[model samples]
Target: MTRKKGPKIVVIGGGTGLPVILKELHQRNAEITAIVTVADDGGSSGIIRDYVNVVPPGDIRNVMVALSDIAPEFKDIFQYRFRSQDKFLAGHAIGNLIIAALSEMRGGIDPAIRELSEMLQVEGHVYPASAQPLVLHAKFTDGTLLAGEAEITAAHKDIKEVWVGNNPWSENKKPHAVPEALQAIEEADEIILGPGSLFTSILPNLMIEDIGRAVLKAKAEIVYICNIMTQKGETINFTDAEHVRTLNRHLGQNFVDTVLVNTEIVPESYMDFNRYDEVSKQVVHDFKGLREQGARVISDNFLLLRDGGAFHDGQKVVDELMNVCSNPIKKRD
Candidate 1:
């Protein structure tokens, strides 16, 4: 008996969400490409970018750790954060500093990431949307402008619009879109968007013109893993349909073909830990609204951290993704 090869998949997102999905896909023996957002401006990544002048490496680091074949000890080393009263070593990870050093020595981010990937023995390729450092700019509903990932995340303002900086950093240099990324999209049977923070994690990558164009032109099934709960400041009152609507607003109406939502009820105790009662309660499945936007909703036991709080069931999410890839449904025009 022979085993069939798994489908190729390109996952576009940043932060914890992309890594979670990537880890699951790797377990399934799927060919994976993670297109990570490089606009991060917080914590260890921020320190490296501000002082060393490099692409924020936090998201990339997360992806590497998620897809790595190394033992837990190595993984722990990659994720270790240093704390000190001294400003120099405070709040920075050894990995972030290493990536910064590599970026400096290699004279570019692509080669630096490649070097790290080799050391980590990662299972899949990870690429930033662009090589240069980019900023995320958001216009509030009141016309106030918020710039940078940190500011936008902390603004506590309703966003009216969002786009990447149009400065020289975002200029014509192609950032050498990873060959693996483009190839994955071109050959992919399916693409998964997220179960991550919508504005900061997911959309930031899509905001890159080249990446968005690739997603638009790719001849593959696109699936969106909706967030289990609304993010505090970023997505205050967004529902499942609203998440899809916002994605369409950015990626285009036809960019996403399916949405996997969590339908399993979570225990009330879990909700307390998640502080669900304090924030927007639940993101109800708006089947009608989703269908209206030409996206099908696949509801299941996607809540993993369920006590009362919702989360993506990693295994179930991967299962649904595999099923969709194996039997793709044609999109309506």
Candidate 2:
């Protein structure tokens, strides 16, 4: 039986949220291009970036593992974390190390990432939003300026504005877009933003000037997969409407054409996780306000906490996105 090729889809985001979407989308015959965020400043990525002076490869590693057409053992090996009193291997992922070594050998991030993708046999292409090591500078509501991803995330302060550093670390003379990423956006039949961290995972990609321009220029239907629960430090009290507003502020006024939100009520029994309680679990979709913003809402059972942590039901979300793409409507401008 021959499977029909699905739509060409470009997903832009980073972290765990993106891999979940990529894994589900790969199940379909869609041509997937993942534009990953590279602003990470924590964990193994931070260690490597500080020591080796390269783009943080953690998100790229996650996306590769998610899209690889390999055995579960392979994925586990890539994701394996070493636990030791040894300072070097303490909390690093094996995949991160592989990426770091490749980057070092290849002279930069672009070639290293390309080699890793080929080695993984990834079903989809993954590109960094920028080859540069970006410092996420934020102007807090209290008028204090915070620099570096770690400092901004830890400050726990309300961000008024954010921008990339004056001198970003890409090899390109200008902090340019990944040509492949931009091409994917231009040719995409649909573009999906994430159910990921609002400020960190999703918005960081948009901070790239060329990527932002490509998104605005793309003719494909733009969709946002709203997060099920608010992020603790980043999106503290953000409602679904507020989330859209924040993204729109970054991408522009009439950016997203549709929003996929979770309307499924989570079972109380599934809410016993300490992490859920810490983040104040609750659905935050604002259907009325979403419509008011000229974006229609597609509500569904997106919440699934299998191992006692909140997560999107990847297959369910993918199914809904496919349905929406098949039945396109003229977006309200």
Candidate 3:
């Protein structure tokens, strides 16, 4: 009998969710590739992108730390942020600054991430959705145009649609997924999206023309790990079906084959509103709606509560993903 190799998984998205899933997949010994969003324009990432003209490193740094097989202390040091009265560096994470510096030294973000990954002894590939920094542009149902991920989400208005492009202030330039990212998606055994901010974190990568096209064409079983809570500005009061609809709408087709939903309820009074203010309520369940969208639904008590917040159980998500890998879904012609 031959030993079967672990599955090749391509995880797309950014924000905190991607790292959580990546860490779990790494522990499962999956061949992982992370496609991080580059449309960030807030906090340490925003500042670094502004000054260095590189893709925001905050998301990439978090992903790197997650896949890194290095010492816990080293990961802490990489994630360290300054709290000095010095206005220049205050609130900037050490890893973000280092990544920015490396971007400059290496002449681009692609090379910089490669260098950092090796240094961190990363267990997988981390590719920015685009080589250059991107601006997220959203057209709200209110017919207002919002630029930048931070601004769009803050608008708190129902979004009609979104796209990735050159920074709004820069000369109009086309942005596409780097070849590595596209290749990863095309060759992947399973592609997972989300558990992250729908518009801001996950969609930015899919907004790239080639990346979206590749995903639609890929032979892999695409799985969307739906969020557990309704996001205030983005997906407020969004049902599980609405989540699938949003992704389908953005991709121009019903591409998702499976959706992993959390069936367990979050205690109404348990969440700390002050800490998780972005969460308005638990994501409403709509099994029939999800199935109607043509997704093979996998519902379970996949909830994990920590620090007064509800999150997907990483281990459970990976278990489902492994199942998807072994018993791949048939592609609709």
Candidate 4:
């Protein structure tokens, strides 16, 4: 008798939260593909993108590490960032530099990731949302427009919407998804989005035309791991339903099939503002609002608090995702 294979899952997002979920999914031996945002234009990724004119490597590198079978010590060394004293490589993670070099040597980010994924013993696929570096543009609710992910983030206003286009350094190249990403979405058993920054990390990937279109029409059950907290600059007062609504609004339809929401309350005085600076407060729940957007909510005590901050329990979230794959919710007609 042949052994059974696990479900095919395609996760779309960026930032620290994405890796946590990926790491847990890899442990379950799920067939995973991470479509990371390349609209980043800050930190080490920004410096490399500016100089090398390649897609930012930060998110992709993190995703690769999450899905890798490499030794623990090696993972640490890869994620280690230089101190300010190291003037030449200050604040840059070793993995970022390595990825940037590979991108140049391989002539494009997609090929570079493929080569690195093999070397790192990655158990899952990692693809940038766009083939080339994307310049993130936003239209604010105040009728203002800004370019660059960093600039848009720093604006700290209500973001009306966001879209991606060619990086200035790319001679006005257009943004398009790699073929692998499209294929992964087309064949996936389930699709997952976020536990990351609503505007910056998650939306940039979907704004790519081909990717967005594919997601809109995908046959798989799409689940969202909603953020535990509302972000200051992006989602200051956003509720769980609002988060899902915002996603639907951006996609021009209610594409999300299920949402994992945390019911565990963060203590009033327990929040350490110093550590989680950009966080405003816990994400308020509105099950009715979620239902209004055609999403079935799986509410649970899924919050994990540590180091004076709040986050989704990756184990719990992955458990829910696995359950969702096997027992998909019946969508209302």
Candidate 5:
């Protein structure tokens, strides 16, 4: 007798939330493909990108560790951050440097990631959304514009729209997804977005011209795992429905077929502002608004607090995603 195959899941996003989802999905034996954002221009990733002229490796490193079935010591070495007094190596993760080196060795980010994935015993394919380094640009509701993912998030202004490009201030030379990234989406059984920053982590991938088009045209069910808490500069007062609306506004259509929302409440005093400064408050519920967006909302107690920070329970999210894959909603013509 032949064994049944697992669902093909393509997850799009970056930052901390993405790894959580990927690790859970890896354990479930799904055919996983992670399309990571290359628009990051801050922290260790930015430093490495500037020095080596490569895609930011911070998100990709985390995703690699998440899906890796390698030994614990090896994983630790990949994630190890240097604390040396030397300025060049200080504050950079070894894995970021390794990725930068490999990117140069292989002549491009896509090939570098492929080589790294094999060496790290990665359980799934990891593709950079674009081959080159990208910068994120945003137009605020007040008609103000900002460049760079870090700058845009730090502005604390209401964002009207966001896009990706080779240059920060100009939209010329629009970014395009690598062939592998596009093909993964086309072949996936389910595509999951978010559990990360709305404008920065998640939207940056979709902001790419051809990648956005591919997602809109893909036959699989596109599901969004809504953020558990409102982010300060990004989605300060955004309701659950507004989150979906923002995505649709960027993509030019209501393409998200399903949304997984956290129904559990966080006590007012439970939040530690100093520790979790980026988080604003618990996202308010608006089932009516979500339904208005034509999304089949699956609300549940998906919240998990660790060290006073709120996050999605990886298991719960994977369970919900599995259900969505098993009983997909009929596709729209």
Candidate 6:
């Protein structure tokens, strides 16, 4: 694919952080394609996935809302979760149920999402990392193994490496990337990773054999929007470069061309523990370490203090993303 009206940007990851970036990107009219994680096995997504036997719709549903140009009432209806009093439907979002049904009816998640995208008037394409649901397996430094995304985080052990495999229901038994996702990676002018979990949300998408291989071989400026605050169970005391190192070690190459880092200080006094119980501290910086790993670092005051917690300012990061796209780099070693 060649350049059209705008830059073709492929954003990868799962969790709440993904939609933040996508929402801002939609405003830019950049040709966007989101390759979302399907390895969730927690909360409403886990329950829906188990019973529906389809990929969890929580993350994908949010991504839809981010890029969709529908009315607010429609968005509300789709995102509405059932009350605890609503027995069978309790905790399930209407969109999740709809996605599950569509996936079942359409024979796969790939086609289901494309159908929904058209209906929602989505500004961009959204692809599940795989057709069938992927089971994320984590190997801890303690030599312990966990099979589910929820379990890996709950264990709070140092993650050594992670990989993906098929659920028992999958006939292939080996995970496969949806072809559209691979093609997006191949054709993208810029590929963005994260603003989400290091080991779970982002890595799970990359762990798929074909997606990882495609990203490694692609001629795009691969940027990692490093998380602003350290997650308690994941990156307790990690430097920005440690995050890059972890990513490089996993892919077995220095594929990251640029890393966007937030330099603003989050005052310890400003953080509300009740609101952000999972947050540890701000991720410290190590410019030397990042340079050693071969990524050009772009640091800025990209912080947004909201609801008594810290997060990346989506516009600030996206501005930098567009700049990187303007002058693309392919700094792989």
Q: What is the C-alpha lDDT of each candidate?
A: 0.78, 0.81, 0.89, 0.89, 0.90, 0.90
Model 2, 1-333: lDDT tens per residue?
112366888999987889998998988978888998878888888888888887788999998888888789988999998997767699899998999899889987889887887777778788888777776778888899877777787777777667665234445554666888999899888999997877877888888888888888888889999988776557777778888888888766778888999887766667655755435556566778888888878887787877767789999999988887776664423
Q: What is the lDDT for 218 in model 1?
A: 79
lDDT of 5: 0.90
Tens digit of lDDT per residue, candidate 3, span 115-160? 8888999888899999888989999988989888888877788988
Query: What TM-score does prediction 3 earn?
Result: 0.96
TM-score of decoy 2: 0.92
Superposed Cα deviation of residue 246, candidate 3 (Å) = 0.7
Q: For each candidate, what TM-score against the reference?
A: 0.90, 0.92, 0.96, 0.96, 0.95, 0.96
Give me the overall lDDT of model 4. 0.89
Q: Which is the winner by lDDT between candidate 2 and candidate 4? A: 4
Report lDDT (Cα) of residue 209, candidate 3.
92
| Whole-structure CA lDDT of model 3 | 0.89
lDDT value, candidate 1, whole model: 0.78
Cα RMSD (Å) per model? 3.5, 2.9, 2.7, 2.5, 2.7, 2.2
Return whichever of 2 and 3 wins on TM-score: 3
**How far is 170's C-alpha from truth in model 6 (Å)?**
0.9
Give the Å error, residue 48, model 4.
0.9
What is the alpha-carbon lDDT of model 2 when measured against the actual structure? Answer: 0.81
Clashing pairs in 2: 132-170
